[model samples]
Target chain A: MHYTRDNMAGLLRSHDINPTHQRIEIAHALFSRQEHLSADQVMAIVNTRHSETSKATVYNTLKLFLEKGLVREVIVDPSKVFFDPNTSPHHHLYEVDSGKLSDIDAEHVVISGLPPLPAGMVTEGIDLIVRVRRTS
Target chain B: MHYTRDNMAGLLRSHDINPTHQRIEIAHALFSRQEHLSADQVMAIVNTRHSETSKATVYNTLKLFLEKGLVREVIVDPSKVFFDPNTSPHHHLYEVDSGKLSDIDAEHVVISGLPPLPAGMVTEGIDLIVRVRRTS
Candidate 1:
């Protein structure tokens, strides 16, 4: 379901963040946009409708979102970072030509199995980013 | 196998990289170490033994290693980049407490079938990284 205003409010409450108008708008932009975005890109979009939202605010809000586990950061390119709003376990195909990112559902690739962690080490979560180049 | 001089030479040759003495030594230091390292860390080790190896060489060699697909770069932590000598297709678990990384073989986690890529997009390799935090 689309992230309604109520949903954004609930998310802010759960994360202990104030559901300010700017925060809600930012969240709505992220949740509504299907494509991955960089912080600068998010800021650009937020500024289009709301001129009061500062770049620093956008960065801080994104950090808060990441801390609350509401967003995922993709590092397909070593130089730049992309943020994905979808929190579900999934992989990505990074288009080398366009620098566009698309999510791949977790159900698709057959993960053979992961080797056990070393002694005294604990397992956490997994990130799979598939980088794609144009073959044709 | 222990990454001896000969072993390093063989690895370089296998990857079509010219096995310079410096490259072999850097390879030895990288493969022999148990910890994941940044280019600076590799430089530290190489300079300790050979005063002639400059930072430029370390960066260049690391780039060569990465280009040849002999090493993997871990992006779990944004502060510093870590390089993995293990080139096998596997995931990683980042220890949030210690910032240590360990390889997870591809067999443990089952990555099933993947969703189709968007129209005009092609599938590429996948990157899986698991971050873990201790409850205590």
Candidate 2:
């Protein structure tokens, strides 16, 4: 994806978001960075450029972005929440030491043969989380 | 997978956990039930029999069971956490209406062939959640 400022603005506009200076800067930081970040991390970066950005705003913006499908919220660690700019279907590789996250591009991870829906219930979605730890 | 009381007590003993009355009752409630339950739900049932069963103890027992790999935690919904008794490698189907979870026994959903790991970063695991809405 192109990381140009205009491209980011246009992307936000396409989602009907106002593309404010704070939102644009936040989007750029998220898209430019290759690592997964929490709201605090994003706020830390955005605050350097825009001192007026509040923690509540950052939290709200992230929630809005999540609702718009612009980003994905990951809860690999129960204590912390991570956000990913890549919204495509993929998996994540969590780092135990640094508490970081990376993408897993697998071709054979499609789930099938689901059991019939429970009585008076309809199926919504399937979630798979594979936890791995270092062998050494 | 014998669903009898003695069989479950034996199973717990096999896992090296002391099969106390509370533990056995919790195990039976989880194994016999067909739906995913949260700690609150487990406590609700456990309290019906033993009025002294506190929520804290139920929570602690659940944690112990999870550490022993006897149960799994499902987080399809961000607001509440759910517990699954199935320990095998599998996925989950979440119900949107009731926020219920069911096991998906697909064998072909293993994720593989991801990008190379970054320096000082080790892959831990992957979490895949597919959200489904009603058609009507």
Tens digit per residue, CA lDDT, model 2, B11-103: 789888999888887888788884688888898887885585777778888898988888888777666677888877667666566564566
Q: Write down the lDDT of every candidate, Cα atoms only.
A: 0.79, 0.73
Clashing pairs in 2: A128-B128, A132-B124
Tens digit per residue, CA lDDT, model 1, B14-130: 999999989998898888885689888888888885496888899888888988898877777766678888877777788889877877777557766766656666665667777
Candidate 1 chain A, run of 10 with poorest lDDT: A116-125
lDDT, candidate 1, A18-81, per-residue tens: 8998889888888877678888888888888648699889989888888888888877666667
Name the lDDT of candidate 2: 0.73
TM-score of each: 0.80, 0.78
Candidate 2: list runs displaced more than 4 Å: A1-7, A48-51, A106-129, B1-7, B107-128
Number of clashes recorded per candidate: 25, 2
Which parts of model 1 have CA positions greater than 4 angstroms off?
A1-11, A48-51, A107-112, A115-123, B49-51, B107-110, B117-123
Quality of model 1 by C-alpha lDDT: 0.79
